[model samples]
Target: MIFLAIRYLIERKRQTLLTFLGVFLGTMAYVAVSGFFLGFHVFIVEQLVNNAAQIHIQARKDYLSAHQLDQAFYENSYRHVFWYFPPSGNLGYLEVQDPQSWYERLARDPRVEAYSPLLTTAALFSLSKISVSAVLIGCNPIQQQKVTSIADYVVDGHFRDLAVGGNRVILGDELMKRLGVGINQTVRVSVGTGNASPFKVVGRYYTGNRFADSQAYAAINDVQRLNGTPNQVNEIGVRLKDYRQAAAIATNWSRIAPERTESWDQQNANILSVFRIQDALRFSMIATVVIVAGFGIYNVLNMTVNQKRQDIAILRSMGYDTFDVVMLFFSQGLILGVLGGACGLFAGYFFCRYLQTIPFMPAAPGNPQGYLHISLDSAIYIQAALVALISSSLASILPARAAGRLTPIDIIRAGG
Candidate 1:
C-alpha cells in the first residue's frame, strides 16, 4: 500500500511539488517569525531586569484622615464641622525616617542579595559656562554595584572611584556632554537655592537610555551634604536572590514596613503589556500562513482523489479493504509533511542567521552599532515542525475518507 501511494504521488509530480512547497514555506515562516519576536521580547525583558534593582523601597509618608483631623482641630467641642475642601498631602520631609533599621533588616534577610540606600536630588550641574539640570543619585559605590548593573556601563573610569568619598562624582555620558566636561574636571552642583558645591568628575557611564544617561552618581554622604539633608536617604534599592520572587516579597514588605515597596515589573507594567500584545500578533500572523498552507494541501489531495477514481475502484475490485485504501492516501500526506518540515527547519535556521547579520540599532542614545536579536531557540523549530505535520495530516483526512467510501460498482455504472 505504501509503495502504491509513492507511485501515485510520483506520477503527479507538479501537484505534489506545489503542495510540498506550501507546507515548507509555512513551517519556515513560523520559525523565522517566532525567533524574531521572541528574541526581541527576551532582550527587552533582560534590560528591564538588569538595568535596575528588582525591588524599590521609597520613603514613607503618613497622611491624616478627615476624622483624625477633626479630632485634633475641634477636640470634640462641636458636633459637625464641615469644610468646603478636604485637607490633603503629607507633612514631613521626603526622607526615610529610619534607614539604618532597614539596612540591618535587609542584611539579615536571606532572600535579599544586596541593597543600596540612595538619596536622589534634583540639581543644576555647571562646568565653565554651561549648566544642565539633571538628577544626582547618591549611593555607596560597592552596594550600588551589587544592586544594579551600573558597574558594567562605566566607560571612562572605575565605578569604585566614587568610593574615595571626597566629593567625587560619576556623570552619565549624555550629562557630561551637556555640561561639556571630562574626567578630572570640577563641576559645581547646587540644590534648591543652596550654596553650590564643587564635585570632581571621576568617572562616566553610558546606559543607552536617554533619561538615564542624563543622570549622575555621587557618594551618599556627599549628596546628603549637597542637598542640605545630612545623613538622610530617600530610597532603597534591593536586589533579590531570585528576582522572580520580587513581586510577592515586595507586597509582603509593603504591608509590614513603613516604606512603600514595588517590584520591577510593577514599576514597568506598561512596557510588559506591550510585550503581551507583540506575542499575540506574532502567533496570529503565523497561524494565518499555516492555515493557508493547509488549504493548499487539501485542494491538491482532493484533486488527486477525483482523477484517480478508476485506480481506486480497480484496487477495490481486487479485494482491497476500505482501511487499506485510506492508509495508502494518508501515507502520502505523512510523507509530504515529514520531508517538507525537515527542509523547512534547515531553511529557517539559515534565515535566522541571516537576520542576525543585518545591522540594526535601537532608538536609544549612546547605543553602539548592533544587529537584531534573533533567537534560534530549539523550541521554535519544534513548534514549527508540529504545526506543519498537524495541518498536513488534517488536510489529508477528508479526501482519504472520501476515496475509501467510493464503491467499484458505482464507478462502473457512472462510466457506462
Candidate 2:
C-alpha cells in the first residue's frame, strides 16, 4: 500500500511538490521563529539573572504610630512642645538584629551558593568641576563577586581592589564616561551632602545596562562610614543552587528573617508578564502557519481522492480491504511530511546560523556589535517536525476515510 501510494504521488509530480512545499515552508518558519524568539528570551533571562540577585533581602521597615507620638509629646511636654511634626527616619539594618546568625543560616542552607551583604547609598561623583549624582553600592568585593557576575563585567581594574579599603571605587563604564574619568583618576565621592572624600578609580565594569552602569562600588566599610551607620548592612543579595527555586526560598526565608525578601522574578513580575505574552504570540504564529499548511494538504489530498475514484473502486473489488485503501492515501501524507520535515530542519538550521552571525545592538547602551542570539535548542526542531507530521496526518484522514468507503457500483454508475 505504501509503495502504491508513493507511485501515485510520484505520478502527480506537480501536486506532490506543491504539497511538500507548503509543509516545508511551515516547518521552516516554525523553527526559525522559535530560534529567534527563544534565543532572545534566553539572552534577556541571562541578563536579569546575572545583573540581579535571585533572592534579595533588605532591611525591614518600621512606622511611627500615634501612641509613640503621644509618648514623645508627653516626654517633651516640659519643653513647651505644641503641634508636633516629627522628622522622617531611616529604616533599620538587617544586620542590627543578628549578622552572625544570618551568615550562619546562609551557610547551613546547602542550597545557597553565595551571598553578599550590601550597604547602598546615594553619592555625588565629582571630577574637578564636573559632578554627577550616582548610586554608590558598598560590598565586600570577594563576596560580591561570588554572589553576582559583577566581576565578569569588569573591563578595567579589579573588583578585589575595593577590598583594600583605600577609598578606591569601581565605577560602571557608563558612569566612568559620564564623570569623564579613567583608570587611576581621582574623583571626590560624597554620601548625600556629607563630607566629600577623594576616591581613586580602581576599576570599571560594563554591564551594557544603563541603570546598572549608573552605579559605583566601594568597600562595605567605606560605605558604612559614609552613611554614618557603622556595623550595619541594609541589604543581602543571595544566589541559590537553582535560581528557579528563588521565589519559594525567598518566601520561606522572609518568614525566618526580619527583612523583606524578594526573588528576581517577583521583583520583575511585569517583565515576566511580557514574556508570557511573547510566548503566546510565538506559539500562535507557528500554529497559524501549520494550520494553513494543513489546509493545503487537505485540498491536494481531497482532489487526489476524487480523481482516483476508479482506482479505489478497482482496488476494493480486487481484494484490498477498506483498511488497505485508507492506508494507501494516509501513507502519501506521511511521505510528504517526512520529506518536508527533513528539508525544513536543514533549512531552518542554516537560516538560524545566518541569523546568529548578524549583529544587533540593544537600543539601550551596552555591548555594541553584539551578534544576534539564536537558540538551536533541539526541542524546537522536534516540535517543528511533530507539528508538521500531526498536521499532515489530520489533513489526510478525511480524504483517506472517504476513499476507503467508495463503492465499485457507484463508480461504475458514475462512469456510465
Candidate 3:
C-alpha cells in the first residue's frame, strides 16, 4: 500500500509539488509571523517591567457625594434640593497621611523587594534663557535604584549623584536637549509661584519614552523642600520579589490600605490591550493561510481519485479491501504533511535568524544600531507543524473515502 501510494504521488509530480508548497508556506508563515509579533510583545513588556515600578501606591483622595454635598450646604433641611451646577473634585490634600507606617509595612512584607517614596510636582525648569515646564520627581536615589532600572538608563554621570542631595538633579535626555544644558550645569527650578532655586544637573538619562524623558529627578527631601511640603510623600513605588505576582498583591494591598494601589499591568492596560489585538490578528492570518493550503490538498487529491478510478477497480478486484485502498490514498497525505512540515520548520528557523541580522534603529538614545526582536520559541514551531499535519490529514479524508467506495462494477459501468 505504501509503495503504491508513493507511485501514485510520483505520477502526478507537478500537482504534488504544488500541494506540498502550499502546506510548507503556510507553516513557515505561521512560525515567522508569530515569532516577530510575540517577540515584540515580550520586548515591550520587559521594558515596562524594568523601567517602572511593579506596584504603585498613591495618596488616596475622597470626594463628597451629591447627598453629602447637599447636607454640607443645607444642613439636611432640604432633602430634595437641586443645584444649578454640580460640585466636582476631591476635598483632601494630595499628600499621603502616613509615610512611616507604609515604609515599615513594606519592609516587613516578604513580597516587597524594595519601595521608594516619591514627591512629584510640576515645575518650571529654566536655563540661562530657555524655560520648559516638566514634572519633577523626588526620590531617595539608592531606594529608587532598587525599585526601578533608572540607574541603568543613566547615559552620562551617575544616578547616585542625587544621593549627595544638596540641590542636585538628573535630567532626562530630551529635557537636557530642550534646555540646552549638559551635566554639571545649573538649572533654576520653581514650583508654582515660589521663588526659583538653583539645582545642579548631575546626570542625564534616556528612557526612550518621550514623556518620561521630558521629566527630571531629585532627592525626596529636596523635592519636598522645593514644593514647600516638607516630609510629605505623594507616591510610593514598590518592587516585588516576583514581578508577575504584582497585580494580585496590589489588589490585596488596596483592600487593606487607604492608598490607591495599582500594578504595572493595570497602569499600562491600554498597551497590553494592543498586544492582545496583535495576537488575534496573528492567529487570524495564519488560519487563513492554513485553510487555503487545506483546500489545495483537497483539490489535488480529489482529482487524483477521479483520474485513478481504473487502478482502484483493479486493486479492489485483486482482493485489496476498502480499508487498504483508503490507507493507500491517506498515506500519500501523511507523507506530504511530514515532509512539508519538517522542511517548513527548518526554513522558518533560518528565516527568523535572518530577520535578527537585519539592521534596524531603536528609538532609545545611545543605541545606534539595533536589530528586530524575533522570538524563536519552541512552541511556535510545534504549533506550525501541528497545523500542517492536521490540515493535510483533514483534506485527504473525503477523497480517501471516495476512492475506497469505488468497485470494479462501478468502473466498468463508467466505460473506463
What lDDT score is found at residue 315 in candidate 3?
Answer: 93
For 1-416, candidate 2 gives per-residue lDDT tens digits of 77899898988899888889988888888889899889988888877887778888887777654344554548756355444665455445434366677888899999999999898888999998899999999998999998888888887878888998978899998898898999999999897656888899999888777888999999999888877888788788899989999999999988987888899989988887887887897789678766876787788788889999988888988999989999999888888888888898899999999998887755322445688889999999999888888888988899889888888888898891
Off by over 4 Å in 2: 62-96, 362-368
Task: Write the number of the candidate with greater TM-score, choosing between 2 and 3.
Answer: 3
lDDT digits (tens) for residues 1-416 of candidate 1: 88998888899899889888888887888888889989888888778777898999998667855555776778866348786776777854498778888899899999999999999989999887888999999999999999998998998899999999999999999999889999999999998767899999999998878899999999999999888788899999999999889999999988877788899999999988988888897788568656866787788778888889899999999999999989888888888888888898899999999998877866332245568888989999988888888888888899899989988988888781
Between candidates 1 and 2, the lDDT winner: 1
The global C-alpha lDDT for each of the candidates, from Candidate 1 onward, is: 0.87, 0.85, 0.89
Higher-lDDT candidate of 2 and 3: 3
Least accurate stretch of 10 residues (summed lDDT) in model 3? 361-370
Candidates sorted on lDDT, descending? 3, 1, 2
Per-residue lDDT over 74-186 for candidate 3, one digit per residue giving the tens place of the 0 to 100 score: 88586888877677779765987788999999999998999999998999999987999999999999999999999988989999989998999999999999999988889
* Candidate 2: pairs in clash: 208-366
**Residue 329 of candidate 2: its Cα lDDT?**
91
